[model samples]
Target: MTGKGGTGKTTVAAALALGLAAGGHRTLLVEVEGRQGIAELFGLGPLPYEERRVAGTADGGEVRALAVDPELALLEYLDMFYKLGAAGRALRKFGAIDFATTIAPGLRDVLLTGKVKEATTRTADRRRVYHAVVLDAPPTGRIGRFLNVTAETARLAKVGPIKTQSENVAALLRSPMTSVHVVTLLEEMPVQETVDAIGELNGLGIPIGKVVVNAGRPPLLTGTKVSQAELRRGLAAAGLPTDRATVSGLYAEAKAHLTRRELEESLRVELAELGQPMVELPLLPSGVDRAALDTLAAELLGTR
Candidate 1:
Protein backbone atom coordinates (compact mmCIF):
# COMPACT_ATOMS: atom_id res chain seq x y z
CA MET A 1 0.00 0.00 0.00
CA THR A 2 1.12 3.59 -0.73
CA GLY A 3 0.98 6.28 1.98
CA LYS A 4 2.97 8.88 3.88
CA GLY A 5 5.02 7.81 6.90
CA GLY A 6 3.12 7.42 10.20
CA THR A 7 -0.22 7.59 8.40
CA GLY A 8 -1.03 4.04 9.59
CA LYS A 9 -0.07 2.19 6.37
CA THR A 10 2.11 -0.33 8.20
CA THR A 11 -0.48 -0.75 10.95
CA VAL A 12 -3.24 -1.36 8.43
CA ALA A 13 -1.02 -3.74 6.43
CA ALA A 14 -0.24 -5.80 9.55
CA ALA A 15 -3.89 -6.00 10.49
CA LEU A 16 -4.85 -7.03 6.96
CA ALA A 17 -2.17 -9.73 6.91
CA LEU A 18 -3.31 -11.15 10.23
CA GLY A 19 -6.94 -11.08 9.14
CA LEU A 20 -6.17 -12.87 5.89
CA ALA A 21 -3.99 -15.43 7.65
CA ALA A 22 -6.68 -16.07 10.27
CA GLY A 23 -9.11 -16.65 7.43
CA GLY A 24 -6.95 -19.64 6.33
CA HIS A 25 -4.83 -18.24 3.56
CA ARG A 26 -1.13 -19.19 3.72
CA THR A 27 -0.04 -15.59 3.76
CA LEU A 28 3.37 -13.95 4.00
CA LEU A 29 3.60 -10.35 5.17
CA VAL A 30 6.76 -8.61 3.96
CA GLU A 31 8.33 -5.41 5.25
CA VAL A 32 10.86 -3.69 3.00
CA GLU A 33 11.97 -0.99 5.41
CA GLY A 34 13.74 -2.06 8.62
CA ARG A 35 10.68 -1.09 10.65
CA GLN A 36 9.75 -4.25 12.53
CA GLY A 37 6.08 -3.25 12.78
CA ILE A 38 4.57 -6.63 11.97
CA ALA A 39 6.93 -8.11 14.52
CA GLU A 40 6.12 -5.57 17.23
CA LEU A 41 2.35 -5.54 16.64
CA PHE A 42 2.17 -9.34 16.69
CA GLY A 43 4.58 -9.27 19.67
CA LEU A 44 7.30 -10.90 17.51
CA GLY A 45 10.66 -9.15 17.98
CA PRO A 46 13.64 -8.41 15.75
CA LEU A 47 12.59 -10.59 12.78
CA PRO A 48 15.41 -11.39 10.37
CA TYR A 49 15.55 -9.85 6.92
CA GLU A 50 14.10 -13.07 5.53
CA GLU A 51 11.01 -15.23 5.98
CA ARG A 52 10.11 -16.44 9.47
CA ARG A 53 7.00 -18.06 10.98
CA VAL A 54 4.65 -15.71 12.82
CA ALA A 55 3.61 -16.25 16.44
CA GLY A 56 0.87 -14.98 18.82
CA THR A 57 -2.05 -15.77 16.54
CA ALA A 58 -5.06 -18.10 17.02
CA ASP A 59 -5.06 -19.41 13.46
CA GLY A 60 -4.06 -22.89 12.32
CA GLY A 61 -3.31 -21.69 8.82
CA GLU A 62 0.25 -20.98 7.62
CA VAL A 63 1.49 -17.47 8.44
CA ARG A 64 4.99 -16.16 7.80
CA ALA A 65 6.89 -12.85 8.08
CA LEU A 66 9.78 -11.40 6.08
CA ALA A 67 11.81 -8.23 6.48
CA VAL A 68 13.51 -7.86 3.12
CA ASP A 69 16.98 -6.35 3.32
CA PRO A 70 18.46 -4.57 0.34
CA GLU A 71 21.91 -5.77 1.33
CA LEU A 72 20.85 -9.40 1.03
CA ALA A 73 18.98 -8.76 -2.21
CA LEU A 74 22.05 -7.01 -3.67
CA LEU A 75 24.20 -9.98 -2.65
CA GLU A 76 21.78 -12.30 -4.38
CA TYR A 77 22.00 -10.08 -7.45
CA LEU A 78 25.80 -10.31 -7.33
CA ASP A 79 25.56 -14.09 -6.92
CA MET A 80 23.51 -14.26 -10.10
CA PHE A 81 25.99 -12.09 -11.95
CA TYR A 82 29.34 -13.41 -10.78
CA LYS A 83 30.84 -16.88 -11.00
CA LEU A 84 34.37 -16.06 -9.83
CA GLY A 85 35.32 -17.00 -6.24
CA ALA A 86 37.31 -13.78 -5.84
CA ALA A 87 34.38 -11.54 -6.85
CA GLY A 88 32.90 -11.48 -3.32
CA ARG A 89 36.22 -10.46 -1.79
CA ALA A 90 36.79 -7.92 -4.55
CA LEU A 91 33.39 -6.34 -3.80
CA ARG A 92 34.20 -6.35 -0.08
CA LYS A 93 37.51 -4.58 -0.75
CA PHE A 94 35.60 -1.93 -2.71
CA GLY A 95 33.50 -1.15 0.45
CA ALA A 96 30.90 -3.82 -0.53
CA ILE A 97 27.89 -3.84 -2.85
CA ASP A 98 25.60 -2.94 0.10
CA PHE A 99 26.83 0.69 0.21
CA ALA A 100 26.66 1.00 -3.56
CA THR A 101 23.13 -0.40 -3.81
CA THR A 102 21.27 0.02 -0.50
CA ILE A 103 22.58 3.51 0.24
CA ALA A 104 21.97 4.61 -3.30
CA PRO A 105 18.48 5.84 -4.13
CA GLY A 106 16.93 3.89 -7.01
CA LEU A 107 19.22 0.88 -6.61
CA ARG A 108 17.81 0.31 -3.14
CA ASP A 109 14.33 0.19 -4.58
CA VAL A 110 15.45 -2.27 -7.27
CA LEU A 111 16.88 -4.58 -4.62
CA LEU A 112 13.72 -4.38 -2.54
CA THR A 113 11.56 -5.10 -5.59
CA GLY A 114 13.75 -8.10 -6.43
CA LYS A 115 13.19 -9.51 -2.94
CA VAL A 116 9.39 -9.34 -3.37
CA LYS A 117 9.65 -11.03 -6.76
CA GLU A 118 11.63 -13.87 -5.20
CA ALA A 119 8.84 -14.67 -2.73
CA THR A 120 6.28 -14.54 -5.50
CA THR A 121 8.01 -17.46 -7.26
CA ARG A 122 9.22 -19.68 -4.40
CA THR A 123 7.34 -23.02 -4.12
CA ALA A 124 7.79 -26.22 -2.11
CA ASP A 125 7.60 -29.91 -3.06
CA ARG A 126 5.91 -29.09 -6.36
CA ARG A 127 3.15 -27.23 -4.54
CA ARG A 128 2.28 -23.54 -4.39
CA VAL A 129 2.98 -22.53 -0.79
CA TYR A 130 2.02 -18.91 -0.32
CA HIS A 131 -1.40 -17.62 -1.37
CA ALA A 132 -0.71 -13.94 -0.82
CA VAL A 133 2.18 -11.56 -0.09
CA VAL A 134 1.11 -8.37 1.67
CA LEU A 135 3.98 -5.95 1.32
CA ASP A 136 4.25 -3.16 3.93
CA ALA A 137 5.82 -1.15 1.19
CA PRO A 138 7.57 2.23 1.08
CA PRO A 139 5.52 5.40 1.53
CA THR A 140 3.47 6.87 -1.31
CA GLY A 141 6.08 9.57 -1.97
CA ARG A 142 8.63 7.01 -3.25
CA ILE A 143 6.33 4.23 -4.59
CA GLY A 144 5.91 5.64 -8.08
CA ARG A 145 9.67 6.02 -8.46
CA PHE A 146 10.08 2.57 -6.89
CA LEU A 147 8.05 0.80 -9.58
CA ASN A 148 9.53 2.94 -12.32
CA VAL A 149 13.03 1.55 -11.56
CA THR A 150 12.11 -1.71 -13.29
CA ALA A 151 11.40 0.12 -16.52
CA GLU A 152 14.52 2.24 -16.03
CA THR A 153 16.79 -0.76 -15.43
CA ALA A 154 15.27 -2.43 -18.45
CA ARG A 155 16.12 0.59 -20.53
CA LEU A 156 19.70 0.73 -19.20
CA ALA A 157 20.42 -2.96 -19.76
CA LYS A 158 18.40 -3.47 -22.93
CA VAL A 159 19.35 -7.05 -23.79
CA GLY A 160 20.23 -9.13 -20.72
CA PRO A 161 19.15 -10.37 -17.24
CA ILE A 162 18.09 -6.85 -16.22
CA LYS A 163 15.66 -6.64 -19.15
CA THR A 164 14.44 -10.18 -18.44
CA GLN A 165 13.92 -9.37 -14.75
CA SER A 166 12.13 -6.15 -15.67
CA GLU A 167 9.84 -8.06 -18.02
CA ASN A 168 8.87 -10.45 -15.18
CA VAL A 169 8.36 -7.68 -12.61
CA ALA A 170 6.37 -5.63 -15.09
CA ALA A 171 4.17 -8.64 -15.83
CA LEU A 172 3.42 -9.16 -12.16
CA LEU A 173 2.70 -5.44 -11.82
CA ARG A 174 0.31 -5.36 -14.79
CA SER A 175 -1.42 -8.60 -13.81
CA PRO A 176 -5.12 -8.38 -12.98
CA MET A 177 -4.64 -10.79 -10.07
CA THR A 178 -2.21 -8.50 -8.26
CA SER A 179 -3.53 -5.27 -6.77
CA VAL A 180 -1.89 -2.17 -5.17
CA HIS A 181 -3.90 -0.45 -2.45
CA VAL A 182 -2.92 2.97 -1.10
CA VAL A 183 -3.43 3.28 2.64
CA THR A 184 -4.28 6.87 3.55
CA LEU A 185 -6.31 9.12 5.81
CA LEU A 186 -9.30 11.43 5.23
CA GLU A 187 -6.81 14.32 5.62
CA GLU A 188 -4.70 16.56 3.39
CA MET A 189 -1.31 15.32 2.12
CA PRO A 190 -1.96 11.61 2.61
CA VAL A 191 -5.17 11.89 0.61
CA GLN A 192 -3.38 13.82 -2.11
CA GLU A 193 -0.61 11.21 -2.31
CA THR A 194 -3.22 8.46 -2.49
CA VAL A 195 -4.76 10.20 -5.47
CA ASP A 196 -1.37 10.64 -7.17
CA ALA A 197 -0.11 7.10 -6.39
CA ILE A 198 -3.32 5.58 -7.75
CA GLY A 199 -2.84 7.42 -11.03
CA GLU A 200 0.92 6.74 -11.20
CA LEU A 201 0.49 3.04 -10.46
CA ASN A 202 -2.42 2.84 -12.90
CA GLY A 203 -0.31 4.57 -15.55
CA LEU A 204 2.38 1.91 -15.03
CA GLY A 205 -0.38 -0.69 -15.62
CA ILE A 206 -0.51 -1.71 -11.96
CA PRO A 207 -3.86 -2.98 -10.74
CA ILE A 208 -5.20 -0.32 -8.38
CA GLY A 209 -7.64 -1.74 -5.91
CA LYS A 210 -9.23 -0.02 -2.87
CA VAL A 211 -8.02 3.26 -1.40
CA VAL A 212 -7.76 2.33 2.28
CA VAL A 213 -8.63 5.43 4.36
CA ASN A 214 -7.20 4.95 7.82
CA ALA A 215 -8.41 6.20 11.21
CA GLY A 216 -11.33 8.33 9.98
CA ARG A 217 -13.85 10.09 12.19
CA PRO A 218 -17.39 8.69 11.83
CA PRO A 219 -19.46 11.83 11.07
CA LEU A 220 -20.06 12.72 14.71
CA LEU A 221 -20.81 16.47 14.67
CA THR A 222 -22.98 16.19 11.53
CA GLY A 223 -23.03 18.65 8.59
CA THR A 224 -20.85 21.52 7.49
CA LYS A 225 -19.01 23.03 10.46
CA VAL A 226 -16.67 24.62 7.86
CA SER A 227 -14.20 26.35 10.21
CA GLN A 228 -13.52 26.91 13.92
CA ALA A 229 -15.31 30.26 13.83
CA GLU A 230 -18.36 28.69 12.18
CA LEU A 231 -18.22 25.75 14.59
CA ARG A 232 -18.05 28.09 17.62
CA ARG A 233 -20.83 30.21 16.15
CA GLY A 234 -23.02 27.15 15.65
CA LEU A 235 -22.18 25.80 19.12
CA ALA A 236 -22.97 29.17 20.74
CA ALA A 237 -26.15 29.57 18.65
CA ALA A 238 -27.30 26.15 19.91
CA GLY A 239 -26.74 27.42 23.50
CA LEU A 240 -24.62 24.44 24.53
CA PRO A 241 -22.17 24.57 27.46
CA THR A 242 -19.25 26.96 26.86
CA ASP A 243 -17.41 25.58 29.90
CA ARG A 244 -16.69 22.08 31.13
CA ALA A 245 -19.39 20.57 33.32
CA THR A 246 -19.53 16.76 33.27
CA VAL A 247 -16.65 14.57 31.98
CA SER A 248 -18.60 14.08 28.74
CA GLY A 249 -18.72 17.84 28.14
CA LEU A 250 -14.90 18.02 28.11
CA TYR A 251 -14.95 15.07 25.67
CA ALA A 252 -17.20 17.06 23.36
CA GLU A 253 -14.92 20.12 23.55
CA ALA A 254 -11.83 18.06 22.76
CA LYS A 255 -13.54 16.47 19.77
CA ALA A 256 -14.72 19.80 18.48
CA HIS A 257 -11.22 21.31 18.80
CA LEU A 258 -9.51 18.45 16.90
CA THR A 259 -12.12 17.90 14.22
CA ARG A 260 -11.13 19.37 10.82
CA ARG A 261 -14.34 19.74 8.83
CA GLU A 262 -12.81 21.58 5.89
CA LEU A 263 -10.07 18.93 5.67
CA GLU A 264 -12.68 16.18 5.46
CA GLU A 265 -14.56 18.04 2.72
CA SER A 266 -11.34 18.48 0.76
CA LEU A 267 -10.64 14.76 1.09
CA ARG A 268 -14.08 13.97 -0.29
CA VAL A 269 -13.33 16.15 -3.30
CA GLU A 270 -9.88 14.57 -3.78
CA LEU A 271 -11.26 11.04 -3.48
CA ALA A 272 -13.94 11.93 -6.03
CA GLU A 273 -11.21 13.11 -8.38
CA LEU A 274 -9.46 9.74 -8.07
CA GLY A 275 -12.76 7.89 -8.49
CA GLN A 276 -11.81 4.98 -6.19
CA PRO A 277 -14.08 3.88 -3.36
CA MET A 278 -12.38 4.15 0.05
CA VAL A 279 -12.40 1.44 2.70
CA GLU A 280 -12.41 3.58 5.84
CA LEU A 281 -11.36 2.50 9.32
CA PRO A 282 -12.89 4.40 12.23
CA LEU A 283 -10.82 6.61 14.49
CA LEU A 284 -9.72 4.22 17.19
CA PRO A 285 -9.42 5.24 20.80
CA SER A 286 -6.10 6.21 22.44
CA GLY A 287 -3.82 3.16 22.68
CA VAL A 288 -5.75 1.07 20.16
CA ASP A 289 -6.65 -2.33 21.59
CA ARG A 290 -7.01 -5.70 19.86
CA ALA A 291 -10.75 -5.28 19.39
CA ALA A 292 -10.08 -1.96 17.69
CA LEU A 293 -7.72 -3.60 15.18
CA ASP A 294 -10.21 -6.41 14.63
CA THR A 295 -12.87 -3.82 13.96
CA LEU A 296 -10.44 -2.15 11.56
CA ALA A 297 -9.92 -5.43 9.68
CA ALA A 298 -13.65 -6.09 9.45
CA GLU A 299 -14.30 -2.53 8.33
CA LEU A 300 -11.47 -2.71 5.79
CA LEU A 301 -12.85 -5.93 4.36
CA GLY A 302 -16.35 -4.35 4.48
CA THR A 303 -17.67 -7.19 6.63
CA ARG A 304 -18.80 -4.78 9.39
Candidate 2:
Protein backbone atom coordinates (compact mmCIF):
# COMPACT_ATOMS: atom_id res chain seq x y z
CA MET A 1 0.00 0.00 0.00
CA THR A 2 1.31 3.47 -0.94
CA GLY A 3 0.10 7.02 -1.30
CA LYS A 4 0.86 10.58 -0.25
CA GLY A 5 1.63 10.55 3.49
CA GLY A 6 -1.39 10.85 5.84
CA THR A 7 -3.75 8.94 3.59
CA GLY A 8 -3.76 6.09 6.13
CA LYS A 9 -1.84 3.76 3.87
CA THR A 10 -0.48 1.87 6.84
CA THR A 11 -3.92 1.35 8.30
CA VAL A 12 -5.24 0.21 4.96
CA ALA A 13 -2.30 -2.11 4.57
CA ALA A 14 -2.98 -3.69 7.94
CA ALA A 15 -6.63 -4.06 7.09
CA LEU A 16 -5.72 -5.63 3.78
CA ALA A 17 -3.50 -8.12 5.54
CA LEU A 18 -6.26 -9.02 7.93
CA GLY A 19 -8.71 -9.32 5.07
CA LEU A 20 -6.46 -11.61 3.13
CA ALA A 21 -5.76 -13.70 6.19
CA ALA A 22 -9.45 -13.95 6.96
CA GLY A 23 -9.84 -15.39 3.48
CA GLY A 24 -7.52 -18.26 4.45
CA HIS A 25 -4.39 -16.85 2.91
CA ARG A 26 -1.20 -16.82 4.96
CA THR A 27 0.05 -13.33 4.26
CA LEU A 28 3.30 -11.60 5.12
CA LEU A 29 2.87 -7.90 5.94
CA VAL A 30 6.18 -6.13 5.34
CA GLU A 31 6.86 -2.55 6.39
CA VAL A 32 9.92 -1.04 4.68
CA GLU A 33 10.04 2.43 6.26
CA GLY A 34 11.00 1.11 9.73
CA ARG A 35 8.03 2.96 11.22
CA GLN A 36 6.68 0.02 13.27
CA GLY A 37 3.28 0.91 11.82
CA ILE A 38 2.14 -2.70 11.56
CA ALA A 39 3.00 -3.26 15.19
CA GLU A 40 1.14 -0.15 16.33
CA LEU A 41 -1.91 -1.03 14.24
CA PHE A 42 -2.06 -4.52 15.70
CA GLY A 43 -1.53 -3.11 19.24
CA LEU A 44 1.65 -5.15 19.64
CA GLY A 45 5.16 -4.19 20.67
CA PRO A 46 7.69 -3.11 18.10
CA LEU A 47 8.39 -5.80 15.51
CA PRO A 48 11.93 -7.06 14.96
CA TYR A 49 13.56 -8.16 11.71
CA GLU A 50 12.48 -11.76 12.33
CA GLU A 51 9.00 -12.80 11.23
CA ARG A 52 6.37 -13.36 13.92
CA ARG A 53 2.70 -14.27 13.75
CA VAL A 54 0.73 -11.15 14.70
CA ALA A 55 -2.84 -12.22 14.00
CA GLY A 56 -4.81 -15.27 12.94
CA THR A 57 -7.83 -15.47 10.68
CA ALA A 58 -11.16 -17.16 11.19
CA ASP A 59 -10.16 -19.84 8.70
CA GLY A 60 -6.89 -20.47 10.58
CA GLY A 61 -4.64 -18.58 8.16
CA GLU A 62 -1.93 -16.47 9.75
CA VAL A 63 -0.57 -12.97 9.26
CA ARG A 64 3.18 -12.71 9.74
CA ALA A 65 4.68 -9.28 10.27
CA LEU A 66 8.18 -8.01 9.48
CA ALA A 67 9.75 -4.56 9.73
CA VAL A 68 12.68 -4.62 7.30
CA ASP A 69 15.91 -2.92 8.35
CA PRO A 70 18.20 -2.21 5.42
CA GLU A 71 21.35 -2.66 7.50
CA LEU A 72 20.39 -6.13 8.63
CA ALA A 73 19.27 -6.95 5.11
CA LEU A 74 22.69 -5.83 3.86
CA LEU A 75 24.44 -8.07 6.38
CA GLU A 76 22.22 -10.98 5.40
CA TYR A 77 22.89 -10.30 1.73
CA LEU A 78 26.66 -10.34 2.35
CA ASP A 79 26.40 -13.60 4.26
CA MET A 80 24.22 -15.15 1.58
CA PHE A 81 26.56 -14.24 -1.28
CA TYR A 82 29.92 -14.62 0.46
CA LYS A 83 30.93 -16.43 3.65
CA LEU A 84 31.20 -13.05 5.42
CA GLY A 85 30.20 -14.29 8.88
CA ALA A 86 33.07 -12.76 10.88
CA ALA A 87 33.97 -10.40 8.07
CA GLY A 88 30.46 -8.96 8.13
CA ARG A 89 30.85 -7.96 11.75
CA ALA A 90 34.32 -6.58 10.96
CA LEU A 91 32.84 -4.46 8.16
CA ARG A 92 30.21 -3.18 10.58
CA LYS A 93 32.96 -2.27 13.05
CA PHE A 94 34.74 -0.33 10.31
CA GLY A 95 31.39 1.37 9.43
CA ALA A 96 31.66 0.19 5.86
CA ILE A 97 28.06 -1.02 5.83
CA ASP A 98 26.89 2.32 7.19
CA PHE A 99 28.91 4.25 4.66
CA ALA A 100 27.69 2.14 1.76
CA THR A 101 23.98 2.31 2.71
CA THR A 102 24.09 6.02 3.58
CA ILE A 103 26.08 7.27 0.56
CA ALA A 104 24.02 5.15 -1.85
CA PRO A 105 20.30 5.17 -1.05
CA GLY A 106 19.66 2.89 -4.01
CA LEU A 107 21.77 0.18 -2.42
CA ARG A 108 19.64 0.49 0.67
CA ASP A 109 16.54 0.15 -1.47
CA VAL A 110 18.01 -2.88 -3.19
CA LEU A 111 18.60 -4.47 0.19
CA LEU A 112 15.09 -3.67 1.38
CA THR A 113 13.28 -4.85 -1.75
CA GLY A 114 15.58 -7.80 -2.10
CA LYS A 115 14.47 -8.92 1.34
CA VAL A 116 10.81 -8.54 0.42
CA LYS A 117 11.33 -10.44 -2.80
CA GLU A 118 13.09 -13.16 -0.89
CA ALA A 119 10.20 -13.50 1.53
CA THR A 120 7.68 -13.55 -1.27
CA THR A 121 9.50 -16.31 -3.12
CA ARG A 122 10.77 -18.24 -0.11
CA THR A 123 9.77 -21.90 0.38
CA ALA A 124 10.19 -24.56 3.06
CA ASP A 125 10.60 -28.18 2.05
CA ARG A 126 9.43 -27.30 -1.46
CA ARG A 127 6.28 -25.55 -0.20
CA ARG A 128 5.51 -21.81 -0.41
CA VAL A 129 6.00 -19.85 2.81
CA TYR A 130 3.50 -17.04 2.19
CA HIS A 131 0.36 -16.98 0.10
CA ALA A 132 0.67 -13.23 -0.43
CA VAL A 133 2.79 -10.29 0.72
CA VAL A 134 1.45 -6.84 1.50
CA LEU A 135 4.03 -4.09 1.51
CA ASP A 136 3.57 -0.73 3.24
CA ALA A 137 5.91 1.01 0.86
CA PRO A 138 7.23 4.57 0.73
CA PRO A 139 5.05 7.50 -0.20
CA THR A 140 3.97 8.25 -3.75
CA GLY A 141 6.74 10.77 -4.41
CA ARG A 142 9.63 8.42 -3.66
CA ILE A 143 8.04 5.04 -4.53
CA GLY A 144 9.23 5.11 -8.13
CA ARG A 145 12.80 5.81 -7.17
CA PHE A 146 12.56 3.32 -4.30
CA LEU A 147 11.15 0.43 -6.32
CA ASN A 148 13.08 1.16 -9.51
CA VAL A 149 16.31 -0.08 -7.95
CA THR A 150 17.86 -1.29 -11.18
CA ALA A 151 17.90 2.22 -12.62
CA GLU A 152 19.31 3.63 -9.41
CA THR A 153 21.97 0.93 -9.03
CA ALA A 154 23.11 1.16 -12.65
CA ARG A 155 24.41 4.66 -11.96
CA LEU A 156 26.34 3.41 -8.90
CA ALA A 157 27.63 0.08 -10.20
CA LYS A 158 27.92 -0.48 -13.93
CA VAL A 159 28.55 -4.25 -13.69
CA GLY A 160 28.93 -6.29 -10.52
CA PRO A 161 27.02 -8.38 -8.02
CA ILE A 162 25.17 -5.26 -6.92
CA LYS A 163 24.08 -4.64 -10.50
CA THR A 164 23.00 -8.26 -10.92
CA GLN A 165 21.10 -8.18 -7.63
CA SER A 166 19.28 -5.03 -8.66
CA GLU A 167 18.40 -6.58 -12.00
CA ASN A 168 16.83 -9.55 -10.22
CA VAL A 169 14.87 -7.31 -7.90
CA ALA A 170 13.57 -5.31 -10.84
CA ALA A 171 12.57 -8.47 -12.62
CA LEU A 172 10.59 -9.60 -9.60
CA LEU A 173 8.80 -6.26 -9.40
CA ARG A 174 7.98 -6.32 -13.09
CA SER A 175 6.77 -9.89 -12.90
CA PRO A 176 3.10 -10.85 -13.09
CA MET A 177 2.85 -11.62 -9.40
CA THR A 178 3.58 -8.05 -8.33
CA SER A 179 0.86 -5.41 -8.12
CA VAL A 180 0.89 -1.85 -6.75
CA HIS A 181 -2.08 -0.29 -4.93
CA VAL A 182 -2.47 3.42 -4.19
CA VAL A 183 -4.45 4.82 -1.24
CA THR A 184 -5.84 8.34 -1.38
CA LEU A 185 -8.45 10.61 0.13
CA LEU A 186 -11.46 12.05 -1.69
CA GLU A 187 -9.89 15.47 -1.96
CA GLU A 188 -8.34 17.58 -4.69
CA MET A 189 -4.64 17.25 -3.91
CA PRO A 190 -4.69 13.56 -2.98
CA VAL A 191 -6.80 12.59 -5.97
CA GLN A 192 -4.39 14.49 -8.19
CA GLU A 193 -1.44 12.74 -6.61
CA THR A 194 -3.06 9.33 -7.08
CA VAL A 195 -3.64 10.07 -10.76
CA ASP A 196 -0.03 11.14 -11.22
CA ALA A 197 1.29 8.15 -9.31
CA ILE A 198 -0.71 5.78 -11.48
CA GLY A 199 0.81 7.32 -14.60
CA GLU A 200 4.29 7.00 -13.14
CA LEU A 201 3.74 3.37 -12.14
CA ASN A 202 2.49 2.63 -15.63
CA GLY A 203 5.69 4.08 -17.04
CA LEU A 204 7.69 1.81 -14.73
CA GLY A 205 5.80 -1.29 -15.97
CA ILE A 206 4.27 -2.08 -12.58
CA PRO A 207 0.79 -3.58 -12.61
CA ILE A 208 -1.72 -1.27 -10.93
CA GLY A 209 -4.15 -2.66 -8.38
CA LYS A 210 -7.22 -1.10 -6.75
CA VAL A 211 -7.41 2.60 -5.91
CA VAL A 212 -8.52 2.87 -2.28
CA VAL A 213 -10.56 5.86 -1.09
CA ASN A 214 -9.92 6.25 2.63
CA ALA A 215 -11.96 8.10 5.27
CA GLY A 216 -15.01 8.87 3.16
CA ARG A 217 -18.00 10.26 4.96
CA PRO A 218 -21.30 8.70 4.00
CA PRO A 219 -24.18 10.84 2.78
CA LEU A 220 -26.50 11.81 5.57
CA LEU A 221 -29.61 11.52 3.42
CA THR A 222 -29.33 8.66 1.02
CA GLY A 223 -30.23 9.28 -2.66
CA THR A 224 -32.18 12.42 -1.89
CA LYS A 225 -31.84 16.04 -0.79
CA VAL A 226 -34.17 18.17 1.36
CA SER A 227 -34.34 21.91 1.86
CA GLN A 228 -34.26 23.37 5.37
CA ALA A 229 -37.99 24.20 5.24
CA GLU A 230 -38.83 20.72 4.00
CA LEU A 231 -36.72 19.19 6.76
CA ARG A 232 -38.45 21.29 9.48
CA ARG A 233 -41.89 20.46 8.10
CA GLY A 234 -41.11 16.73 7.96
CA LEU A 235 -39.84 16.72 11.54
CA ALA A 236 -42.97 18.53 12.78
CA ALA A 237 -45.22 16.13 10.89
CA ALA A 238 -43.47 13.13 12.42
CA GLY A 239 -43.86 14.70 15.93
CA LEU A 240 -40.79 12.87 17.25
CA PRO A 241 -39.42 13.98 20.65
CA THR A 242 -37.38 17.17 20.06
CA ASP A 243 -36.93 20.65 21.50
CA ARG A 244 -36.34 23.93 19.63
CA ALA A 245 -32.54 23.78 20.09
CA THR A 246 -32.45 20.12 19.03
CA VAL A 247 -34.38 20.90 15.85
CA SER A 248 -32.02 23.74 15.05
CA GLY A 249 -29.01 21.41 15.46
CA LEU A 250 -30.56 18.84 13.13
CA TYR A 251 -31.11 21.50 10.50
CA ALA A 252 -27.51 22.63 10.73
CA GLU A 253 -26.31 19.02 10.34
CA ALA A 254 -28.52 18.53 7.31
CA LYS A 255 -27.08 21.64 5.65
CA ALA A 256 -23.49 20.51 6.29
CA HIS A 257 -24.28 17.05 4.93
CA LEU A 258 -25.74 18.45 1.74
CA THR A 259 -22.66 20.56 1.10
CA ARG A 260 -20.25 17.73 1.86
CA ARG A 261 -22.20 15.31 -0.31
CA GLU A 262 -21.87 17.65 -3.29
CA LEU A 263 -18.13 17.93 -2.84
CA GLU A 264 -17.77 14.17 -2.39
CA GLU A 265 -19.72 13.47 -5.53
CA SER A 266 -17.48 15.76 -7.55
CA LEU A 267 -14.34 14.15 -6.24
CA ARG A 268 -15.79 10.68 -6.76
CA VAL A 269 -16.40 11.52 -10.38
CA GLU A 270 -12.84 12.79 -10.72
CA LEU A 271 -11.50 9.56 -9.29
CA ALA A 272 -13.62 7.47 -11.63
CA GLU A 273 -11.89 8.99 -14.62
CA LEU A 274 -8.63 7.37 -13.56
CA GLY A 275 -9.93 4.03 -14.90
CA GLN A 276 -9.03 1.82 -11.94
CA PRO A 277 -11.20 -0.23 -9.60
CA MET A 278 -12.13 2.11 -6.71
CA VAL A 279 -12.90 0.92 -3.19
CA GLU A 280 -14.09 3.37 -0.55
CA LEU A 281 -13.78 3.08 3.22
CA PRO A 282 -16.08 4.94 5.57
CA LEU A 283 -14.77 7.32 8.20
CA LEU A 284 -14.69 5.70 11.64
CA PRO A 285 -16.07 8.27 14.04
CA SER A 286 -14.91 6.25 17.05
CA GLY A 287 -11.40 6.24 15.58
CA VAL A 288 -9.40 3.14 14.60
CA ASP A 289 -9.36 0.28 17.10
CA ARG A 290 -9.52 -3.47 16.87
CA ALA A 291 -13.23 -3.46 16.12
CA ALA A 292 -12.87 -0.72 13.56
CA LEU A 293 -10.00 -2.54 11.95
CA ASP A 294 -12.04 -5.70 11.76
CA THR A 295 -14.94 -3.80 10.26
CA LEU A 296 -12.58 -2.40 7.65
CA ALA A 297 -11.13 -5.81 7.01
CA ALA A 298 -14.58 -7.26 6.47
CA GLU A 299 -15.44 -4.36 4.23
CA LEU A 300 -12.26 -4.94 2.26
CA LEU A 301 -13.29 -8.55 1.72
CA GLY A 302 -16.19 -7.25 -0.33
CA THR A 303 -13.76 -5.82 -2.85
CA ARG A 304 -12.71 -9.28 -3.85
- What lDDT tens digits, residue by residue, belong to model 1 across residues 247-266? 34655665665467666867
Where is model 1 poorest over a 10-residue stretch in terms of lDDT? 241-250
Clashes of 2: 0
Candidate 2 residue lDDT tens string, 61-106: 8899999988888999888889798889999889889888899999
- lDDT scores in order: 0.73, 0.87
The pairs that clash in candidate 2 are none
Q: How well does model 2 score by local distance difference test?
A: 0.87
